[model samples]
Target: MKAEEMWKASTGKGVKVAVVDTGVNPDTPSLKGQVLTDEVPKEVSYKATEDYDGHGTSMAELIAGTGADGTLRGLAPDAKIVPYRVALTGLDKAEMQKAPHLAKVIRAIADSDVKIINMSFGGKIDLPDVREAMKYAHDKGKLMFAGTGNDAMETEFTGFPAAYPYVVGVAASDESGVVGEFSQHGNYVDLAAPGLDVPTWCDKTFRSYCTGEGTSMASAIASASAALVWSAHPDWTANQVLASLIDTAGRDWARDDPSTYLGYGLIRPRKVLENKDFNPGPADTDPLAKENFRGVVDESGKPVAASPSPSTEPSKGTETSDGDDQGDRASATASETDTSGNTTLWVALGAAAAALVIGGGAFAVIRSRRGA
Candidate 1:
């Protein structure tokens, strides 16, 4: 994605992204004047800016960090963040109990003016209340994104919130467009983004950025990508925004036979932004209608409906590569050059070293215990 060129069109200005994660530190050098603390509802705003682990702040910075004082530059630096904190692994037991419920936080965000909800976290359990909350947010027309998960080695369980219908589940990929082996794969993955070797806050201290990999980072990037598209086409509804992404995503395989590892393909918001006259289909028609309707279990643990799948013409004029054979591993290491001329770690290593070699353990515990 030629981010600089896309910036010539839109910097995600005037868009608000609701980050439903651990919390966001408003005082961070890059986040100053970016996080909307007061906009968070009073009832579920407890410790909204107190990030126990550095993960929440990292995700926040990935989406909207202003890149001040050598900090990470966000993909949507001009967007605003409405932070929310919920219980996760490593939090003190008492504190975790005191945090607002996840469903309530989701509901609050649904009722707010936030255009996007970025949940860079996941869990194996699919709680009905959480799914209902997600549905409520969807009904309210919010564009939601979540990590498919980082524990592809330990479990094949489809991560929830990500598996929930109407939510865009994102998987991790390298700069070369190779899906990370650590990225859990399933029919639920809707898109892919760069996740390997990304710089992240090492801990709660926020002292330095450490190399990390997981679907968490991928989800953040996807959300920011949507922000850029939404900012460029302010009149487009959530469906249209998502449809635009699906229309222009980089993929090698037929769109109807989406890869289980990379989803539709690596998200390339630049393609959508570059085309001023791009048609995004209908505002009410879901791009993933077939996948959402087929074989998906609802919060009530029941099948909704089996609808005839819609047809998609193969995308032309974009780069293409062979789809990964399920469970095949490969290797490469690369750095991403930011607008400031800084070389940050972009995931290194091919498929073989994708899971065990990358040190993404930090995200595993947090996501696994999201609602435990």
Candidate 2:
């Protein structure tokens, strides 16, 4: 998104986005003036803006980076970032040994005043505390967005935070508008965004930048997109904004039968923002009523979520690797087949390790220090 476009309309100027991930270093040139640490609750406020792993910082940059020193430019540069550090990936060995304490961090965010929450992390397990906090934030009118996880070709399971109802689940697609091979899919995916070879913070050290791929990047873009919409229509409640996004999301499938792979299709903020005459329908009506997932009630007051019967099976996808003449490798185990109909792609490796190998190959070998 361009600054000129934002200036002409709304560029997330007044919106405060809560980046709930590893941590964000305030010293980064692009985020020098955009991070807010004082507002975080005192209990979990330590390292609120100190990004130990670069992933959180990169997400922040994608959401509100000012593009200093030709760094990564955020989708909503004018927005403010409220860093809410969690212990998803960058904790020390000692911290990991103590049994990951993610619940406390989520609880703190639920009590904050930020209106938009961006979660770029998730795992297979659905932590009870985390789900409860999501409900709290939703009831508080805060728009929450999360990555659908990135283990697409391997584990077909969608990530947490995204699985929760009322949360906007984001997947990844390339510049030409094809979904990435690694973006986890299912009924959870609500929107897609750009998440390939994009610039990102190198690490918590705040020393340099690198290019990487993951659903996390896509989630950040989705968050930034929400910030743009919210910035333009500040008076609209969270429900209204989310409803508009779903209603306007780009999709060719039946409005009621969302695809398991693409979900609601790619997100085109340009379409929604360019048309000022667009009406988002009713605020209370959920556009995804007919899709999988059951308790979700639609305009007709019918259940929209999948039932808990034997017929309801988990979705799975198969990824094919190029250069190697081999049969498609179905993720260890999952439900449903992902045939994009016409789109074929190469497979991607796992996250963290791949981020280091593919992105920091030379840097890691020469610097003798791997990113946390």
Candidate 3:
């Protein structure tokens, strides 16, 4: 994406991204001064800095980590992170009960100064409560991104939150720009980003970085990309920010006919940043209104045939001891029960070496190779 050239214009300085996941570790070498714990709402905030499985910390770092102490730098280093802890699949039963409800958490973030909400996790079942919370956030004009899930190897069920209206579903891709086989595909996919073979925290210890990949990481990058565009034009509404991304995204197919694997193609924030005269269209008009208002389709881009709830199986986080095979792994956050009483699976993004980053001056650096 040659993001470095675009960084000459914006570094996502004034933007604040809400990392809605397990929890964000503020003490990480790269995130030392980036996390804003005090800004979090007291009611919804519980162990907001305690990362249970390293997934939340990695997503936080991917968006705003400062890259201090030689740790991985985020795509928007100048931006700030607001951490929120919610119940996921792998959390203890007692601890999960203590965590705030997903609806409350989303509403709190919607009322906050956060302009972007990055949910690198997803669930299979559609929960009305969660959907309502997301709608509230959307009404407040917030840009949200979520992983489409990493269950491409298995079934093609739509990942919740991402499948919801107005929430952009992001898919994972490699340096070569090919979508990962694990990235879930459906009409809900709004955009794609580098997700394969990226650097992430090895575990909750936050001691060292390891290679990992999944739609989770891709969602973080997409959120950071929006931060860059929004930072450059702070007055732009959420619709405008998203419209700019869809307008400037890289793709080989026609804009109207988006790819199921890569919706609107790989994100290229630089294209929007470089064009000072870019028109972002209407503020209230949603860029994804058609998909949201009309109806959703299956992985083949056909209209929804059936809604199946996949059983919650603990997937391993993608970790590779060698640079060879990238297999299934644990998701960043555990699966949680939806309103349907079904256990929802959150895609586990582990380590891989896909090129997802390019330099953007000193402030805009994602953990990927220098070229697209």
Instruction: Name the top TM-score candidate.
Output: 3
Compared with the true structure, all predictions reach lDDT values of 0.70, 0.60, 0.72
Residue-level lDDT of model 2, residues 180-227, one tens digit each, is: 666666667777665566666555566665556666777777777778
* Candidate number of the best lDDT: 3
- lDDT (tens digit, per residue) of candidate 1 on 1-372: 666667789889999999887789999887999999999999999999999877788888888877777677778889999999887655677887788988899999999999999887766665778888988998898999988765564445666667888889887766666666567767777887777667667778988766666777788888888999999999999999998888777776666667666677778788898889999889898787766777666799986732222112221111222221111111001111000000112221232321111111111111110110
lDDT of 3 by residue, 271-349 (tens): 8988999999998888887667555677788753223232233222223123211111222233532110000011122
Candidate 1 ranges with C-alpha deviation above 4 Å: 295-372
- TM-score computed on alpha carbons, candidate 1: 0.81
Candidate 3 segments whose C-alpha is farther than 4 A from its true place:
295-356, 359-372
Kindly provide the TM-score of model 2 when superposed on the true structure, using C-alpha atoms: 0.77
Give the Cα error of residue 238 in candidate 3, in Å. 0.4
lDDT of 3: 0.72
Worst 10 residues of 3 by lDDT: 338-347
